[model samples]
Target: MSLDLGMTNAPGSTPRAPGRLGVPVSAAEALRYLTDLGMWLDERRKQLDAIDQAALSAPDQSDREALTHDITVSMALWKAISDRYELLRVTFDSGRVGPVQAEQLSTLIWGRLDVAPGDGREATRARMPSGAESNLAVSLPEACRLSDAMSSSLRARLALETTGLDVSIRVKGIRESVERIRDQVSMMPLGATRDRTQRELIALEQRLFDVTERAKRGADVGGFLGPLEVEVAARERDLIVAASRRHESERDAARARELITALAARGDAIRGLQAQCLAAVTPAPKLAVPDVRALGAVPDDPDAIDALLARLGLVGKALDQAHETYARALGERDELQGLLGALDAQVAGSPAVTAAERADLKPMRDQLAAVLAATPVPLVRARALMAAYQSYVRTVTNNGRAPL
Candidate 1:
């Protein structure tokens, strides 16, 4: 028999009866259910998208695995909900009946459906059906049984999905923590400890990649473990390297400071010596003396006169030695001054242009010429010359006939 499955009243107006199949549901109720289902699906899709985004942004293998896990779980949940909804729709469309039967079917559907609790207590209580006499009578015939089976299947699937999600979240959190430690430890300066730390991190990263691969293949969750051990080892090594480098730097700086201090002190001492030399070489002005008259006229003793002449000779020798020392000092000073001037000219890019300056110093370049130039010394040469000069001076004085 052909059944007319049509609602007697407006959508969501309250069913008059219960228990029947092929009864038209209120348009409003159907639209609300579809809307709620769409929202749920959208939310799940968003979660999946978020997971994908997170995986792309992850810096390491561990985080990527974690995001993969989350996405898988969310997809599973979405599939389960969609499957149940499709099954329900197919079952309802199979049979058709009158408005009364439709009202009864709507009641039955509501009775079996498990409405999720809302955040507001009053709203939850209002929307939720209670296990009471009137409400119990409003249940549809086959609807409860079908809904119970579907709910059971959904619950099982949800449990599995939730477990996967939780595991993935936990892995991601752990991976993030390990990564933070690695970053902090790696920043330390290079040394034995830093090298050790780097090795440890590399090892941990390898292990993490293995775990991620296993997870992608849907292996045992327990397989993803051990990055922590590697991170700890790396951190310890890094700390040691940083400390060693810091200590070495401090020691080097201290040595340099000490060297600078010592050089400065030595420079001051040299400057003092230079000042003393300059003072010693400074020339003193000569003073003029007036001639003194003899105290008294007396008869001279020959022995006393001889002693006096000997003292005069000694005084003359002393004066000559003093004059020679002064002359030598002056010559040395002049030589030093000339060397300074030449250095200054060279520094200014105008080197001295003289024959002596350009001359190349050579040892024994003309030995034969040197030997030929040497003259044989004449005995009493200086004495003979002096005697002749003295005689000439006396002759000239006599010729002049001025004064004896």
Candidate 2:
């Protein structure tokens, strides 16, 4: 009898019979079963190695851990397969079966135990579980084995069918749903509201455009004739005032130059008189007048005495004239310095000059003014008359040589 157990049905649905439990064993069958088990083990080992390689090449720590978990699960599945194979080996060896008969017997035993159907169906379901319940129930080792078997079965099934039928059905359903949604959306009043909003936006844009155009025109007018006009007018007024002040400064400088020249001339005359007085006080060289008794007796006469007194009187008059000249020159120098001071005061008091300039000129003017004010009137007038005489001479010389 043959057992056809399908795991899709509930457990104990099929009746258990004795003959269907095991088949006659052969050595060839046993060897074949062992060979198949060995191949499965080798494949599982290769799969574990691949998982290890994936873990090594993983991009992040989390991915490496996931790949290592997969390798551990594959190793577990390999161990399970080895256990099942050993159980089959024990059954076959006790029955004294040939290798070929052992392989058949093993297949029957596995079938009777309902292990083969459970493994194959669970393997397929494990690959792509129905829902969260199947996912929770399957171990990682079982999932790895199921995934390999189900993927191979799916590929074979797909190869036997016509192309693109499943995709066409999905595409049709999607198209219908999309069309229904589009029709419902088209029936909405959103299009009218959108049009109204667009019109309002256009009106606002037009107003903004007009305002920007007016602003551009205002900017152009301001650029052409704003602060620049005021600046130019102010600069022109400043230039005129500066020119007037410059003319006044030039006149003042000329007056100062004339006063300095007069003072220098007077100083020279004073220095010359001082030099003359110093020379008069110096001792003259002595002459030797020995062994001339008659010449010495003639010098004691009255006529010689009267002539010597007249010569001394003339020397005294010349000395008095030189002193008068020095005093007059000094007085004249003080008067000129006073005039320079007055001119400086006028410049300083002018509104055109700044406060700092006035402060600088004021001290110099005060010093010269004090000296001139302290001088005696008679001396000052005499010095003034002398300056007038010098000025007349300079004027005449500038006019070229003439009869005096």
Q: State, as a TM-score between 0 and 1, how close model 2 is to the true structure.
A: 0.23
Question: How much is the lDDT of residue 265 in candidate 1?
Answer: 53
Question: What TM-score, computed on C-alpha atoms, does each candidate reach?
Answer: 0.21, 0.23
Writing each residue's lDDT as its tens digit, candidate 2 over 319-345 gives: 455557544555455556665544555
Question: Candidate 1: misplaced stretches above 4 Å?
Answer: 1-170, 177-199, 215-227, 230-237, 240-404
Each candidate's lDDT (Cα)? 0.38, 0.38
| Local error of candidate 2 at residue 256 (angstroms) | 99
Model 1: how far residue 258 lies from native, Å: 6.5
